[model samples]
Target: MKPSEEKPAIIALPKARRHTYYFLNYADEFKSVYLDTEIDMSEVKRRRDKLKLSGHRISYIVFLIEAISRVIRLYPEANSSVKHGMIPQMAVYHRIAAKFTLDKTMDGRRFVMSGIIPDSDQMPLEGMQKMIEYYRDTEADEITEFANVRKLQSMPLWLGRWIYRLAMGNLSRRAKLQGTFTITSLGHRPIQAFYPIISNTLCFGVGAIEDKPVVMAGQIAIRPMMKLSLAFDHRAIDGALAADILTEVKKVLEFASESDEASTQGEEVTPVGAST
Candidate 1:
């Protein structure tokens, strides 16, 4: 052999030592839940109609932002992650990484948009909607813009992966500070639901609306239903807390229609001496 290719350094460890090393090196775990909720689509539709009159189509994005805000407010525990090799910490960052498609052609390009959520408890729903509309309406321009970003295009796959890991490591706590959640709306497609695949993050998938019987007031009634799948890092949150978070989110969506109806009715009412 050309200069005996120095046999790879063979350093072996005892079984127990190896087991300990592997366990300590493990990153995190993912847990998911499929939640079916009764949501009223009528209000969302009406809002879309109103927005259409204004030449803006962004009702879905507004709804998502509102829903996420409610979830974060009600279940703060879900907005957190475990600190590696240390006791888990409670985080409070009102930032989330939103994934968006760049082009409709070529199987579509994907990118993550961070800092979508504001620092306050209230989110800029209208602003976010406008941003999404701008992105959606100018697909060609966005694609061209991304192409012009030489660094993004020229990075090698392995280098990209390394960069991603490093960035995630540095931003883990900052991103998971307050409203750390992922929402993916694939309901427009045929896919039913997706399992947790992202690392150190809670992922939620919104699926198509279906007709289902759900208890309203005190009796069971048929209503339009949507499925919500939530994936959490099991190492950080317990099963009970995760379930509680999902339960609260369902409650918010289920009553969203009622709230919208009440608001509409209030707006339509004429004051004491209103003109006809």
Candidate 2:
């Protein structure tokens, strides 16, 4: 192999990424458990296509948020945060907040941002779409959350880390800043699965949908399948509960039909005996 004639380019880290560095530092303290499974998207895709043809378009990520939000409502423990103080405490939220990742370009460079949808279980598909559209349409610097993250980069390193810890280490503060659960997707690319450090008790990663051979009713058939990966904080939730939540989410997507309601409507669930 011939060596490159030109040297590699080295650039300074973008200010927008300071939050990520701080986040990773915090996430490193967690005991994260990873799991991935392929979900058959036959029914979900068919229903989504039908909706699109009827003029209502829903992306896979939004569909997932809708399903997961409801699942969190059913299993409130997954929507919790843990702070390892002398007396460790877990904060179980009554409302479901779904956080989704976004790719934002700032100053000719691409960066990542995220937005949270509050009371996600109560929002319909159309409402969720509108929220997503607002986030995508607005400039990153204009959003308060994104702007604040960028501002952190300008602060002294110790101060920035201190502020981040104060926010992330408190259960109530973390819930407001990071949300109850997170969902990130790379469905536009060819990747199948990946495990990510979690900011909350549960963080789900979505992979590209592709046609794969799957067994249905004792017969092999080609179906459009997507790999769903989950990273759960074992300190906040047990493996059995995490597996149950993942399984429930998988079934919810696989069996979704055109006639099924596109949202779960109800008041927020307050888990019994759960205190902040």
Per-residue lDDT value at 93 in model 1: 44
Mind giving the per-residue lDDT tens digits that candidate 2 earns over 1-276? 346766778865566666777888888877899988889988888878887888888888888998788778778767898887788888999888888988987777687778988888888887899889888899987877666687787786678878998878878878778889999988999989968789999999999999988888999999999999999999988888888888878877887644554565633333323452
lDDT tens digits, residue span 124-178, model 1: 4456666556656765335443342223334554454454445445445336322
What TM-score goes with each of the models? 0.62, 0.89
Steric clash pairs (candidate 2) = none
Q: lDDT for model 2, please.
A: 0.82
lDDT of each: 0.49, 0.82
User: Which candidate achieves the best TM-score against the true structure?
Assistant: 2
